[model samples]
Target: MNNNSQSLTYTQALEHLRAQALSKQSEEEVPLISALGRIVSSDQVAHRNVPVADNSAMDGYAINAEAQSASGQRFPVVGQTFAGHPFDRRLTEGQAIRIFTGAPIPEGCRFVAPQEDCEAEDGFVTVTRAFDEDSNIRRCGEDVRAGDTLVSRGTLLKPQHIGALAADGLATVPVRTPLRVGLLSTGDELVRPGNLLESGQIYDSNTFLLFGLLSSLPVNVTDLGILPDERDVVRERLTALQGTFDVIITSGGAGKGDADIVGQVVGELGNIEFWELAIKPGRPFMFGSINGCNFIGLPGNPVAAVVSFLSFARPFLLARAGAPFTEAEPVLLPAGFAIAGRRPGRREFLRAKRRFDGAGGEFVEKYRHDGSAQISSLTFADGLVVLEETLTDVTKGDPVPFIPFSQVGL
Candidate 1:
């Protein structure tokens, strides 16, 4: 794989990344109760039709359609049928079956008159209103037919989906196994939280940010902690992680610096497919692998690391886990603020907060500060505003594409 990304547009880079989704997918069978949020391995087809039989939709009198009636008609009530019980005997013209909601309509019964529209006497029912054709009947296979596709492959199971599958009498479902992912933060000047910071050092918040995002994904994440900028040490750790992880993500040590050894070590150990992206706030993005295990190296700047992860790494990991592609599109939002400067050469993404105004109009406001190192900007915003490369300026009320943190499971 080529490490250099020369003249590669953002769309082209994304396409290349998507093409790397896992060819060898893994899946497991689990009870549907525990399958929420898991991706389906294949289409879940219905084994049996929903509402297996033609049943009553309301508590009523199941009567024959041939019965003569205008406003008044009387018939003897022979038996009753509850939800879980059914009348075994057949109903002729002079007899009506007392049926409750969801009770199977006995043979020869064609319509149901609501219990409220009938007068009941000793073992008999007098009809005050007649049922129309097909009224109060939940026909067999009305909701779902046998062999119909219930849910397609790569679907992230939800409550409604589970309900539908359960109604189809499915007890177990096949879902993709979680991908094994590892995170490594590099930089000698970085320290984990709760430790006292010395001169020229910052807390290792990148690990937590990545961990939080990864926790929400359908992947198993291993925190490798912070490593020094030494080439030997970084190489040793990368070697140790190769066999255990499907993809290892590292932050820092990808730029032109004396301490930047991650990219070089990755090149020596495995391959660097691409090392740079044509985007602002995260240009020093690196995607490569070591010993057949993938690795994505992000910039040391906190915000840049986050943006790169969401824009590039998020989709890559989800696709590897066999997730659906239709859910990855960013939502369109109305731009609330104007662009500050002339059009940038590379694509730009701004952290923004989205909400509606008094008239229920939706808009997104961006943080004025565009520093890659600023962590406050991330917390202050709920989503990101994507500006196209061809776009120089954004006027108020223009449609701006926005990616919500919720979509990435942040």
Candidate 2:
């Protein structure tokens, strides 16, 4: 077995994975209402007119701008225009129409004065304020032009995107189908929860943790349950699940142990592209392919598994699912408390809770416990305070880069 232990840096590993994922998958058309959280496979161009036709912006009188004066000009209200109704009547030099919000602007009128600035008497209306040209009138193509691109390709469809498409009269949108993934766990000392744990055996938490994480993504996940640390069983399961899922994610058994068979199985079944990373706690992470299905081998430690999945696997899955390229950009803020001791060459993500100081200033304070196996650290943290690979010491007043979990939809 070739044990080329030259590990890849975090940036290099991400670049390699992105380069390997060159195949663009098929797309499907989904209803506008059901397209939230889905990625658009194609550019969404406006098919019909936006605002559909000329409409009102407010519940006010639609009249000629030149007809109103400072003292007040009164004109008889010939007809009324409500939403979904068009006044075919043409407004003469001194004539005006009573209009509601979203109603089409009547012909021969170029301006609309809001109702608050106007007073209605008997059958006439008086404008007390000077109305500007095109005031309160929503033009036919003001929101969006015909044939304009409402949303570009690779955009993750949010509620705002849906509104934009709906305004363009699009009832359905074309989006990429969710990627299917197969999940597995390997460890002889691991047992599922509710089962009896013998002396040294530990309850398996990686499966549930991974399942919860995968559930939030735009992917279809198939749980392969737990597999023992035997090479043959691992190979058998990999062979059976081949061609069914786009990717396979296995936790544990990537380390250099006698029973660690994931690296060997990846090499035997397919190409082992990379076996290790330079990141802390997740240095033994592995990436490869088995029978054309991508495989990721994560560390056994619960916190390390979640970190690796979030930093590396999540982006790849999103890109394959047609989401736009998104990076975990950090926000620089002052640290609330002083942190002691730091490694110089490797980046560290310390769990932190965000709080506002007495002066109403926001700050992130590091948690007390930061063990790799402490899953509760992540649950209690609002974000991660990133200590750069170059910085060896940090003071309380020093600026630090932090990434909030909420921004990434975690």
Candidate 3:
């Protein structure tokens, strides 16, 4: 619980936010069909081995590896095994069984000779060449053993994971319940879209922007609408939301302006763990708690709101929802532009588009404007170019860290 005088480094603040994740962890069992995008609550072990039996991996003739087979040697084909059918009888030396892919191999069979490598005539197979040793057999438990962990706890379930769980015959899985998140936007000069705007009033796009971002997350979001700059109204609305939400995210009123009463009221109602960050476009960001619910206040500028949310709020919320939090690893690429006459001491994220040269070289081109209020820059951007705090100037072709929007689920 500190004020703006104790602004935290990005790494320090993220560590602090993720440390509180376990306090909000809870679990529920859901059908496998409904488990996509949900976090696993515990390790899911395989109940049975994949390919429960040793099966043929190709359409071929299953024969004993020890059989005396040569170019002119012929063996009688006694049985046939399809995918759903199996040859129950045992195989003897110099005997061959016709088998298809996924069909269980007959007893005493150690190799499968591809049908193309042998000649079949009058219920007999003639080996055209030497036998391959123990080939084309999918062994039991090769993919998954009964006691092996199929998926670890805290994994964000994806399609491949669902397939693995299905292979183990799982009808239901245990996952963390979605977090309850509330969204609030504060500004007196803001008006909702589809409404006529008066003097000095602009459409409130932050509500939709934050709503779209929250919709992609594993949380149930409730839109609390917009609040004016009045301190009493902001406090009243925030007070009513204290215990109902797992986290309350508010945009605007986090700065020191006269109208920025949201952070002030939050401090009075609960605790402001940190009120500032050492980063450009999000320096006014705030994180705290009211009653038992967590709170995050974002800057009013549209682009700043986005950067703060992705860099801080997204990871924190995911961690609290039983998923592990890890910082996004940036890909280093050369800068397509130059930076000069910029102050140091704060990390900055610039909206950028990646360009590739004809010879397979890649670089990042930053948006023309660096203002936090430039919302159009985000639309044209494919990702963010990260400038270190100690970096004062960046010449064209200098290597810089870049993080694509897809990496952060944007």
Candidate 4:
């Protein structure tokens, strides 16, 4: 935290929180097959080249393209190669080797004539056009060299990364240890998902939303269940979680009131950077540290909790997990409908689903209802049409920044 003492913007807060996370995270060795979504602790250098040798990209005939006749001509098939098998004999002049995809090209072969481009017979093939050198041939070390860096440090390993690592014959990978996160939803009116709800009580959805979001990351989650809106009890429960979790997320009591005691207790015990943000459905947010653990307090409203957690907590957690800090890049989409009378100074994340036009182009149709308490909007929402804080009325066909649910876990 800087000494300026001014309230931070959403971007500034994100930068500050990320700056606090790098070294406190730990590293571990994990099985390669199970490393998806895990952050890489260090750069992974390839032990061996992918393909390991010059190979065929298609089921074709390997021939020395330079040896072909100027007008292109027939060549006798000398030997055959299959995947996991290679023709060891040197390819002779005026001869072609039958090779399957992924089969290592024989010595003296410089090009591959795809089967579709060649007329094949019992033991010979004819080409009407001269085969280009290196065409259809996957060169050795082409995809990855033996000493190339496969995955860099702080990389969030995707499925493609896993495959690349496996190509180097690695059985395990070095990754950061999963962030230990404790999730607790507050409010006495909240009930367990499986339990019967009374007239005044409702089933807890924030926890599920948080869980699903966390499940997509590399984290070990401990659900603290629901906490009643008692100040003392909230403080006691929070104290118990201290020193046990890397981060604690609480969903209620972040406002300014005796009933909203989470922020008060956090401020008393540690610090609260800024609890009130100028963002719709996610204004009452708390971010600070306590007992060596980071804390984030979100608003009690269902949609608010979801939006706040995604917008703020996720970046902090990813930085702590040693993953690269990637801000969600927005896509410009055409508004399917017009919106009016929106207030300024607070960014609005309007719920929207996909709607295709006559030309099959995708556009966004904003949901008519914008209540934070309406949890169903989270389901109907395929993306968020981010209307900026300074702007107001958005007419049809206007360009705006949009983010799909897939970019940030639901």
TM-score (C-alpha) between model 3 and the true structure: 0.90
The clash count of every prediction, one per candidate, is 0, 0, 0, 0
The collision pairs in model 1 are none
RMSD of each: 3.2, 2.4, 2.6, 2.3
- State the lDDT of candidate 3 residue by residue for 1-410, as single tens digits: 45656777788778888887663658899999988888899999999988899999989899865533455678899999998798989998778989999999899897888888889999998877775567788999989999999999989898999999999999999998899999988888999999999999998888899998887778899998999889899889998887899999999988766668998899889988545788988888888889989898999899999999999999988888888887888999999999897787788999999999999999999999999999999999999999988898999999999999998878
Candidate 1 global TM-score: 0.86
lDDT tens readout by residue for model 4, 258-339: 6777777787778666556778878777778787788888898989988887887887788888876667778999888787
| Ranked candidates, highest TM-score first | 4, 2, 3, 1
Inter-residue clash pairs, candidate 2: none
lDDT score, candidate 1, position 137 = 87
Top model number, lDDT: 3
**Candidate 1 lDDT score at position 309:** 85
TM-score of each: 0.86, 0.91, 0.90, 0.94
Is 3 or 4 the stronger prediction by TM-score?
4
Error of 3 at 73 (Å): 6.8
Clashing residue pairs, candidate 4? none
* Quality of model 3 by C-alpha lDDT: 0.88
Instruction: Give lDDT per model, in order.
Output: 0.84, 0.81, 0.88, 0.82
**lDDT-based ranking, best first?**
3, 1, 4, 2
* Higher-TM-score candidate of 2 and 3: 2
